[model samples]
Target: METSLEEDSRTKEFDGVIFGASDQVFSRYEDSSTEVTYTYILQTAGEFGCFQRILVALTFIPNILSAFFMLGGTFMLKMQPHHCNTDWLLAIQPNLTMSQLFNLTLPRKKDGSFEECRMYTPVQWDFDSIVKYGLNDTQDCQNGWFYLSHEWSLITEFDLVCNKASERLRAYCIFVAGLFCGSLLVGTLCDRIGRYKSILLMLMFYAVFGLGAAFVPTFSIYQMFQFGIGIAIMGYTISSISLVIEWLVSSRRVHAIVLAQCFLVLGHLVLSVLSASIPHWRLLHLVGSIPVIFLVSYIWLLPESPLWLMMRGNVEKAKFLLCRAASINKRIIPPELLQKLTNEKIHQGTIMDILKSPNLRRRTLILSYVWLCIGLGYVGLSSQLHKFPINMNGSHLAFRLVEVPARLCSIISMEKLGRRKSQVLALLLGGLTCLYSAFIPEDLTSITTTLALMGQIGLSAAFTIACIFSAELFPTGLRQVGLSFVSLSYSIGVIGTLLIESLDHDHPETFMTVCGIMTTVGGLLCILLPKG
Candidate 1:
């Protein structure tokens, strides 16, 4: 009799018919009783007030760190100008200038560029013997390689130039694989353990492995750390974003998400400055990841999601958090609203929940494909930007700057046109821009550069919209799982981009064309998704 009474109370609390705020339905309750729902209570607490703003601000730290760890690789693993390390010749001729040394020991191609991987065989004789012998022989770098700049990079530190060049691609693949695996593991953890705990756990992983990446001595060990960073970053991203969105009401969710994405852009901007100022990759990575130590203080500062608490049937805790939010927002939650907050224990969603339902399965497939294209297009264009005539800093700054307007546009479009159309518009615009740029002649560097920036703008908007849309499509219980599944496709896309680059390093046009086609297809499929 006692257990049956508790079940009856749980059903009454959750089965209440609630309506939107616009309808002025706050006072309505099930059986004409005063048992309000979490949604209504969250609205009553205030949607876009002081509490939400503070949470949004806290998210910037992780987003910026995400940029550092994710895009930092652009500079950290870059291919610097290098040649065979032939400094041994200096032993015979101490006065040899760098130009003299290169002219004597290195072979030149038909276009007069020195061979980067091979140098003439060295001899013990004085420099005159080498000059007299006319140095016709060449072999793989006998000593190793020398970079124009001694600054640390994967290329310089790992000797990834000649035979080892392929290792860079392999390292990237390993990192992406980590991201894929982390999405599954962390997404499940977030749903099972609650968002706050998941964030804390992922932060620990991110900081430890990120620092480990900076200090590891060998390329093999470095790859191991990179893989760990990959997993940690994906988990951090999914958990943090989910936490933020869960706290916000539907009306403010898009705006808050857009605001958080701006921090991600700022992260890239900060990364550009740091990359320029910090010459050593290890030090740069160290600086980027070290902030997590400070961020750990969030354990005391951040609050658990009240809705999650309610879903887990910790009604008293949820009520306390709601009251706190209301107090901070300077609103009074009537005692009656808190008196009947008895929610049942909702089942935590799993990957099977997404697959068992046909509606969810369709949405997951479509959103996953969209996410995949967004990842490929965004990373592909950003990676290829250096191929243009602009300087490196300028390209990076310009690319990140575009996101400011792009995300702003996303907010407006999502609010005005709704999710499906907004996503389709952003994707198509990005796709067409990329495709058009691909056909442009290589001589038109300015045109190509401008078009690339425009394409990124569209992609940036699409990325922001996709994040919100995917979250909204799933219920709170399944939100993290659904997002993780979609994000797995993103990892696949990144890996695909890397493979394309490895296959055709010389022709970025082919890669861009492929990205454009895939993005367009993803956008067109959005039409089939159920309308908002």
Candidate 2:
């Protein structure tokens, strides 16, 4: 029985060897061996490597230019003078009876002119003096000059709050809308054409519309121009993030992206200083538009992402870029390895893909909510600085300035600790700080103000982290769409600002309460985000 089993095993082994040899030969003859085809294509594609390096350098040009333009407008608007000194002093004018002031300031309706003739209400020095001295009418009051005319007062009042708030809201809405729309359009175009081309298009938009915004004669026209600026900003935001992510090594991707965000904070800080110093909205807008000229250089200098090219089945372009990268990094690419490059065909996913996969769906939902909260809460809070315990304009500018270092800290910590941990911690801290701020007694003192500011700092850090994390969570193919969708939440939040009362003295508590609640909810939602 043992001898029969041995014979059977030997016969089986011999047949297997014969079949394997025949299969190999057949595959070679049919050109059906995937390994061979992969190698052949890689060799051909590797020849054009030098061209890729040039394109990578070009990408940063447009981003920097776009940043300058977007932030410049913020600075200009911040600096523009609105409130007059006379209004506040006039309200508290001493030694004047209320009726006497009305009679002195009342304008004559006939021919719509002001007459010098004025009247004063009866006044006595004291009740006892009037009874005892039979009214001492000998007291002469010096004739006071009218420092502010009724017309000037009316114009000043119009400029003080009503007109200013309307203009600001209009500008803010236009800017946010343009940014959201532009990002979506640019993101889609990036997928269709290439990163470099999308950036060039954004730069053109920025140069034209951004500069035009600075010269708009009326507030309404300015808002329209700002909408154009928004479009350019949206285009730059989507394309720059995509292009930067594609060019860097996988290990460096997070670091590079966070660093780019740090620059965003820096842009804000720069705007703060410029806005504080310039004191004119239009000039600030002009300064913002100036950087766009730098972007024109990108038209000649930038390169398309090799990864994007590879995904599109442009093997030759990918090889050319990779080889160029290798040369720039001073690393050798093995010819044999180069010969192995081949495209893997991946299905282009629709927006539905984001919702179809459970894990992806959870991520998208959480991210979108967090993004919405960040946009609404942070921007709403920033916009409401006019209603804070501090001076509105000064606090608004200062808050922006404070974000610079906060963003730097976030960039450093995000890379060191990883995206998930940093984001969670930021949200947690922000929420707790916000909650703490609510209990602080109003009119408390410097301590309360400090705590409120600290809470703001925490919220700002969380916001910065959300932008970075959202970019990191989505895969490259759907990144722009994912970002745009999340950004749309921000615009939704901006609209919420209108519903809330923003008058500093009358409704401070209401604004603060709303901000605190929004920030807390945003932070809580942030905790559920998946580990990236």
Candidate 3:
């Protein structure tokens, strides 16, 4: 958070400028050296607007699939009103109806709902006159639970309700733990092998693992699939998007990244529709996995980032892609001119590079905090909303719908407000609104829903901005490294999301307040980061 003049000098030392490079590229240069030495892949590819469009298409589906990956858990873990099965009671009185059995055998709580975990009278296998007298003795469910609805869930199938309900949260935490591991693995692959190849591997893993999760017989086996899904989700995300983004100049970076981000929002909306329409959790996952087969075209169709190729010292390959891009855009660059562009190597980075470089180090630390906070607050609030009376389909759709406008606004504000301020503003506004909403009594449902929606919008916007901000802050070599750290933080945040289960029901204020504080702290940390 230091503001010393020395630190400012250190930030400025990251080569020439990046953000303002677009304007300078077109401006009257002082000499030939300026024009020759400074050129971005975007500037060279801008003539082919179709190229960007195609790249965006390549990036979009992966983002949607990533959202679907997480959404599967929402549907899979969905809870329903359930209680001890009436089979034993039915056996005692074979002629009794289902409703009659429930009334006679199940214990009712203060809420007038049948208790899910407990039942009236023990199953001593001695059905005497006590059955007709209505025995008052109560005991924990011994046989199995009866799900009120036909819609199957892990909660109903595995008896993850009542005391063991916390297992549901633990399951998701394990998934995110896998994501943390995946981010590191994918980051290394993307950094070493290349974006295109790394993503192909990820998409394959996603298809096999994600779809395979649907048929698992045991909850423990299902968890293994969830873990693999997490790994694939984050890997597909970083590799595909980073590849396309790295090829673009700063001017279109926000638009391209936001487009990729919007796909995730759209994916979430699609998930709501799928969850509501499909009725079965397994079918929903099956539908989501179908896209993986379609994305196989990416193997040959998607091109490697020319900048990445040059950075990898593949000048000839980079030249071929550039020619293909130029052909697609219908623009011509002189052979001599294109040859000189790949003259220097874009620095290859190791994990230590992020720590050793003063400018990169500061940006990484600040962005990591912001990423972690956004994940924590955003997931915490979303998870808390599950207890409310909001319609699952409508709320889920509306929640994702808002992100579209929020991200659009960020694209405009990013240019005007700059990275740090826009990001800080997003975090601050989201945090403050969440805190304010905590004070509103639950009876005021309308007001609370509005505030919750606003909070999501802000958090969504902050998350988008922070991602773009991170891209601009670090050099290409260190970009994936920074992404790895950010993903690790976010995965930890998702793990922390489990806390909402304990806190959301009893101490509502405590839940909202903790999420608010984290986002606000992220904002403060963002202020210390130098503008890119």
Q: Residues 1-532, candidate 1: write the lDDT tens digits.
A: 3457655553333223234432211112211322236667777888767877788788757888888888888889888999998988888888988999999999998999999988998777767777887787788898888789867777787788888888888888888988988887888787679889988887887778877788888999988888888898898888888888767766777788898889888889999999889999889999888887888788988888876786678888888888888888888888897776776755456777667566667878999999999989898888886787877877899899989999998887876777889999999999989999989998998888888888999999999989887876765556777889999999988888888887565775788799889999999999987564
The list of candidate 3 runs beyond 4 A from truth reads 1-42, 122-128
Indicate the worst ten consecutive residues by lDDT in candidate 3.
23-32
Count of clashes, each model: 0, 8, 1
Q: Clash pairs of candidate 3?
A: 48-329
Q: Which parts of model 2 are misplaced by more than 4 Å? A: 1-103, 106-165, 387-398, 415-417, 501-506
Please estimate how well model 3 matches the true structure, expressed as its whole-model Cα lDDT: 0.76
Best by lDDT: 1
Tell how far residue 393 is off in model 1, in angstroms. Answer: 1.8
True lDDT of residue 32, candidate 2? 26
Q: Clashing residue pairs in candidate 1, if any?
A: none
lDDT of 1 at 274: 92
Candidate 2's residue-wise lDDT over 138-171, tens digit each?
A: 2111232332322222113224233244565566
Q: What's each prediction's TM-score?
A: 0.91, 0.71, 0.91
- Model 2 lDDT vs. the true structure? 0.57
